[model samples]
Target: MTNHPHASSDAANALAALAAAPAAELEHILSEVCSSPAWAAAVAAARPWSDRQALLAANRAAMAGLTVADLNDAMAGHARIGKPKAGDATSEREQAGIQGVDTALLDELHEANAAYEAKFGHVFLICATGRTAATMLAALRERFPHDAATEAEIVRGELRKINDIRLGRLLGDTA
Candidate 1:
């Protein structure tokens, strides 16, 4: 029962104990473990997990299963401020590699981001891993030109990516 352990011999036991938990308990455990609805819903559906890989596989499968409503619910927990918060815990954890920008730059990005959201009727969505702030800004600018249908699909994809990150974090839970 340490705070950190990776793929330990007891991992299967821990996972089974979680997977066997009742739905309310599952939701509660997973809620503490991960806050995203898409991730939580996916974990909840991953009952009877065979092992860590099975749990991860279920998490991925769940992302693929997300409905538009589910994606929006997942997105609800993230920052959609007129400006992005540099290193916002939720976004940083979910999109650490993908969404970080220099704190100094968020102020400048705010107006353009707001204008883009205003035109699109939804917040800009990016997978936010392995990219720079400037890169993300460029993506936002480019995506702004996309029509609603295209943007909707892109948002859905972004939500799925977030779900994946949350699931990995939760599945990497304490021993």
Candidate 2:
């Protein structure tokens, strides 16, 4: 993937566009990546990224700085795993594994989602991009036993994975 000749230039162009965008516009764009205003603001303030790597590093740093409240803010933006938010292509695409799942499995997934949320006080989150419905459900159940602090760290890690994928898309880096 690093062998691609135009990758660097493309990333530089994307970074430049982000850097030059108006504050509101940049924040709005970033909100789709991670809903926490503080995260968006931190990344936005560190504009004029030198390269794709720099932007990615900034994203990691900003994510590490997120408070529990900020994590909640980011989590609020995601829909439940099986129930993708209307018009949210990202959620729909990521949760594609749940599509056409058996009725019994769907019902079980719904019930598990409710229970997970009840226990964790947030939606069941996973990097559903390439995972099956059963896989996500199993993860939800597995994580259910974890304490709040542990779960929060897991959520942060998942959120970082999601952020990296989204930012790659934003930069048109399919590879």
Clashes of each: 5, 0
Q: List the residue pairs that clash in candidate 2.
A: none
How close is every model to the real structure, measured as TM-score?
0.69, 0.93
Candidate 1 lDDT score relative to the true structure? 0.64
Please report the TM-score between candidate 2 and the true structure. 0.93
Global lDDT scores for all candidate models: 0.64, 0.88
Displacement of the residue 126 alpha carbon in candidate 1, Å: 1.9
> Global lDDT for candidate 2?
0.88
Q: What is the C-alpha RMSD of each candidate to the true structure, in Å?
A: 4.6, 1.8
Candidate 2 runs further than 4 Å off:
1-7
For model 2, residues 1-175, the per-residue Cα lDDT tens digits are 2557897777677878988999899999999999999989988888878777778888998989999999999999898988988788888888889989998998988999998889888998888888899999889889989999999999988988888888888887663
Give the C-alpha miss distance for residue 21 in model 2, angstroms: 1.1
Report the number of the highest-TM-score candidate.
2
For residue 141, what is the lDDT in candidate 1?
84
Stretch of 10 with least lDDT, candidate 1: 166-175
